[model samples]
Target chain A: MKSAVIVFPGSNCDRDAQVALRQITGQEPAMVWHTESDLPKVDLVVLPGGFSYGDYLRCGAMASHSNVMKAVKDHAEQGGLLLGICNGFQILVESHLLPGAMLTNKKLKFISRNVHLKVENRDTPFSKSITGETIRIPIANHDGCYFADDATLDQLEQNGQVVFRYCDETGAVNDNANVNGSLRNIAGICNDRKNVLGMMPHPERAVDTYHGGTDGAELFKSMVEALA
Target chain B: MKARVHITLKNGVLDPQGKAVHNALKSLGFEGVDDVRQGKYIELQLEDSLPEDQAEEKVKQMCEKLLANTVIENFDIEIA
Candidate 1:
């Protein structure tokens, strides 16, 4: 499947995402810069992680309003698959593509570690490859904690939008299993049923044996295979 | 005219930074500090003679569209 990766001023993870996509899909995905309003014809749009716009004025705040985001938003509205990771997740939240907001970690420090994530909703485009299973993905970010009003959180839970929950190695949901201490120990979530996904974990960073293992590879495989 | 927009996390939203500041203030021996809510103050320079209401509306639009996430933040404007 064809894919496109969005690149913003401070997007450090764009290359990693491109490498992962190229490895999985056998073709290099187009790198669309944030300043340009054009988008190549593609099946999926991936918003890779980084300190976009230097993380000034809150993470992803500046990047969400970039010229390309309008196109990305339009593309997403057309039901094309969209996956946002790390700072990309922040951009999604800032752009209102997803509900809720990201806050500083409860401990008020940047955290980088391998985290266990339970696949809460496997029917989604991003998690369909893993069926009711737990996976290990690296999460690294400062403002990763997710915060929403009680009513909104309840609604999210009720709608089954909470796609990934933090879990222990044995796959048991528990507190602190999530690297960022998100409410409900949520590591990732999907919009409505599936099409769009936003998570703090770096699936691309974990997609190769050189990095660690290819456990995160299935996330991309799911998207590509599902699209086909 | 210049306007200052103060953006703060709304009530019921977890404020980890605010909590950290509160802890630091207490450790520094500040007394009677009931709470600490961290926020941002942004100053915007606008054309002179702009109507105050219009300027305020523009600032509000800025906050809602980009400056602040209304899901967890509220902003107020002060013009001078």
Candidate 2:
């Protein structure tokens, strides 16, 4: 499947997403800068992680209104696949592509480590190929706490929009395993349409064996299969 | 005209930084502190030609659009 990765000014993971996509899709994904008003026609659009706009005016607030976001919104509206990782997830929430907001991590510190995530809703296009119920991914950020009102959380749960949740190695979600204090241990969520996904963990970063294990490779493979 | 905006997290939203500050204050032996919440104060300069009412309105709009994240924050604007 063809894809394009959005590159904001401070995006440090654009190349990671590109590398993962190239490995999975067998072609280079276009790197679209935030200043550009349009996106290349592709099956999937990715907003990779980084402190866009230097995290000013809230984490993703400024980058949410960047020039290229108009097209990203358009792409989501067209039912095209869209994925946001880490700070990209922050931008999606700031953009209202997904519900909830990110706050400072509960401990008031940045968390950088490997965390186990249960595939809460694998029926979506992003996780359809994962043959297992859990995956290990790396999360690195200070403001990764997910927050939303009770009503919104309930709605998302009822609609099956929550795609991943922090869990133990045995796939048990418990309060202690909640890395960033996201409500209900949420690690990733998709919009009601299921085409847009915003996740805190960097699946791209986990796609290479050299980094660790290739547990994240299935997510990329899932998207390719769904898009195909 | 100059406008100042106070952006604060909304009620019921967890403020980890504020909690941390509160802990620090308590650690420093300030027992009288009831509760502490932290927020941001942003100042913007407006054109001199703009009327006071218009400037306040514009700043309010700015708060709604960008200065404040309405989902998690509340903003108060004052123009001078």
Candidate 3:
């Protein structure tokens, strides 16, 4: 399946994501610059991780207004699959493609570490492979905390839109599940119909055993298989 | 014309930066500081005297599009 990864000024993870996609899909993904104002025809669009605009005015505030984001928003509305990881997630939150907002880590410190994530749903195109089971991916970032109003949080949970829950090595959820102390320990979420996904963790960074594990490889492979 | 956009986190939203500032203020021996909510000060110089309605609309669009994330922060505009 053809995929495209959006590149903004400060996007450091675009290449990492592209490499992961190439390894899994056996094809080089298109690299779309943020200023292009359009997305190439593809099965998936990825907003890779990075400190866009140097994270100057808040994580994604500046990058969200780029010319290409308008097109990205339009593509998502037309049922195109979109994945926003780390700062990409921040862009999605800022663009209103995903609900909730990202806040600085509760400790106000930058956190970089491998995190365990329990897959909550396997029905969507993004998670259809691996039998919809739990997987562990390294989450490395600051400003990864997620927040939303009580009503919004409740609606997300009630609708089964919460896609992944943080977990410990033992596969348990608790404060450890509360990455960055996000309320409800939400690590990743999807839109109402489950097309767009925004999460703080860097799955692309964990796609190889050299990096730690190959669990994340399936995330890209699943999308290719789904699209095919 | 010059305009300043005040972008602040909405009430009930956790402001880690504000909390740090408040702690620092307390450490500095300042009292009577009920609370501290850190916000942004954006100064924009437009090319022309944008009408009130037009400016308001542009500012709002700016906030929604860039200045603020409606999920966590709210913005107010002032044209000068």
Candidate 4:
């Protein structure tokens, strides 16, 4: 159940992930900086959200080329579980650990609010504990809209790689609930091996009662139980 | 030598920022604008004394590797 959270220069959510991991897993996770060329052995590696490299060139472009991404990619290649939340998701895609890319929000505005996500699949280690339900998590970003080609999208859907989809509180996927205008309401997806997951929502920001929700706690617990 | 790279979203990809600009142009009374797509232009100064063809190829390699994300972007390289 050991985990490490990657902290880039502009990552604002590293501590949030750290606190959430510690509170949920009952162990202090390592805070790995982006410059480190290697990672200590850990069960999971998290890419937290923030304006890495001040979102220059692209949201996760500069951070993806950082020294630590090599280790992160190696970790995923070894079947180690990797999770990228928000900007972390951007980094994963930029690193090609996951498919697709992010684009500006459909309305050209930064959105910060809680949105319901339907659990599309629970077969992976990250969501094994989650039963069929809609969970609320906070999303805050300007470039959260996910885009991929039609063929790739079809494959993702057919292979069950889509793990999460934006949905209404009633557990129905609809345009009204797709605040970011992501294609097909896709909020998150896993790699072909299902060892890597990238999502725009901030589960770490919703893991405590003080945060007004604990829906994200089960995800961390699921990973720990599956790995440990 | 200088390598200029232009990265643009591929066809069929949505461009919200471009759409916003298009709408703004319409509001500003600009007509005959069929469409708009936003992109990035990067200029790189090479330190090597290579031929234009070789340097262009090198910049193209750079574009494929880092300058552009081939998934949703198309990069055009110009050498000067």
Candidate 5:
């Protein structure tokens, strides 16, 4: 499957995402720069993690307005698959492609650790493999708390858009498992159409055994199979 | 013309930075501080030749479009 990864000025995870995509799809994904107005034809578009624009004026705020976002938005509007990880998720929310906004961690600290995540809904393209109840991935970020108004949260829940939630190793969802204090323990969610996904965890960091676990490989494999 | 824009988080949203500042103030022995909320203050110098009202309206558009994220922030514009 063809894929492209957007590279913003301050994106440090672009190469990691490229490597993961290449290993999973057996194709070198196109690296689209932030200033470019066009994107190559591809089956998937990825906005990887990192402090885009140095996280200035709020994380992902400045990068969201770049020329490339216009094309990305248009592509997503046309039902193209889009995956945003970590700061990329912030950019998606900032661009209004996804709902809600990411606020600073409730403890007012930058958290960097591996946490367990439960697959809330596996009906989407991003989580169709492994058949596992939970997966372990690394999450590193300062502003990773997900928040929305009551009505929007209810709508997202009703539509089954809440894709992943913080969970224990035993797959229990509770306050204790919510590492960043995100509302409803939400760690990842898709848009209403289920084509755009935004999540805080760094799946790319967990794609190899050398990284201590390959749980993240399932996500990429799922996408490849779905597109195939 | 100059416009000063104040961007603040909406009420009910948790402000970790503000809470940390509030805790530090208390630790420093400042009494009677009920709460503290931090916000951004931005000053813009307009080179447009529009009228005062028009310029203010333009600035408001700027705030809505980019200065503040309406989803989580509220912005107020003051023209001088």
Candidate 6:
């Protein structure tokens, strides 16, 4: 499937996302800069993780207002696929493409490690190909804690928009398994339409067996198949 | 003209940074510190010729649109 990855100033993970997408799709995805007002025709738009704009003025706040975000919003409104990982997730929230906001980790420290994630909902394009119930992915961020007001959280739950939640190795969700103090242990969520996904885990970091496990590759494969 | 805006997390929202600072203060033997809440202070220089009311309105709009994320934070603006 055709894809594109948006690059902003201080986007350190853009190249890593590009390499992962190229390996999976067997074609180089377009690298759209933050200043561009338009994006090339593509099936999916991936926002990679990084401290965009140096994480100044809140994470993703500045990048959300970049010129390229207009096109990104349009793409999502049109129901084209969009996946935002880590800091990319923060951008989606800041852009209002998704609900809720990210807060500093409850422990007030940056967390970088491999954690277990439960596939809470598999109906969305981002997680449709998963054959297993849970997966292990690397999560690396300081402001990864997910938070939303009570009414919004209720709405997300009622709409089945929560796609992933932190869990133990055996796939049991508990407070101890929640590395970050995310509300309800949310690790990923989709927009109401299920076309846009935002998550804090770094799936690209685990897309290859050489990296450790190939669980992350399954997510990419699922998206490619769903588009096809 | 100049304006100063203070942006702070809304009440009931978790403030880990503020809590950490409160802990540090208690460790330093500061007494009667019932609570500690962190916020941002931003100063802006505006057109001097603009009327006071207009400048205040503009700064309010700026805070609503960009300076403060109303979803989790609230902002107060002061003009001088």
Better of 3 and 5 by DockQ: 5
Candidate 4: which docking quality band?
Answer: high
lDDT of 2 by residue, B1-80 (tens): 89999999999999888888999999999899877889999999899999999999999998888888888999999889
- lDDT tens string, model 5, A87-141? 9999999999999999999998899999999998888889988578999999999
B1-80: candidate 3 lDDT, tens digit per residue: 77789989999999888999999999999999989999888998875856877987887898886777777878989887
Chain A TM-score across all models, in listed order: 0.97, 0.99, 0.96, 0.99, 0.99, 0.99
Candidate 2: residue A63 lDDT (0-100): 94
The C-alpha stretches of model 2 lying farther than 4 A from their native spots are none
Give interface RMSD for all predictions: 1.1, 0.7, 1.2, 0.7, 0.8, 0.6
lDDT of 6 at A173: 95
> What is the CAPRI rating of model 6's predicted complex?
high
Per-residue lDDT over B1-80 for candidate 4, one digit per residue giving the tens place of the 0 to 100 score: 78889999999999888988999999999999999999999999986679888898888888887888898899998887
Write model 3 residue lDDT over A1-228, tens digit each, in one string: 888999999899999999998888888899999889878888789999999999988888788888898889888999999999999999888878888888889888888887888788777777878553567888777898899999999999888888888888777888956769888888899999788999898889988889888878877777887888
Off by over 4 Å in 6: none
What is the two-chain DockQ of model 2? 0.90
Q: What is the TM-score of each candidate against the true structure?
A: 0.96, 0.98, 0.91, 0.98, 0.98, 0.98
Question: Which has the better DockQ: candidate 1, or candidate 4?
Answer: 1
DockQ comparison, 1 vs 2, better candidate? 2
What residue pairs clash in candidate 4, if any at all? none
lDDT of 6 by residue, B1-80 (tens): 88999999999889999999999999999989999999999999999999999999999998987888899999999999
Better of 1 and 3 by lDDT: 1
Comparing 2 and 4 on lDDT, the stronger one: 2
lDDT for each residue of candidate 6 in A1-228, tens digit (9 for 90 to 100):
899999999998899899999999999999999999999999999998999999999999999999999999999889899999999999999999999999999998889899999999999899999889999989999999999999999999999999999999999999999998999999999999999999999889988889898789888999999988
Candidate 1 ranges beyond 4 A from true positions? none
lDDT of 1 by residue, A1-228 (tens): 999999999999999999999999998899998888989988899999999999999899999889999889888889988999999999999998999889898788898888888888878888888643788888889999987777888988888899888799999887757667788887888888478899998999889999886778999998887987
RMSD of each: 1.4, 0.9, 2.1, 1.0, 1.0, 0.8
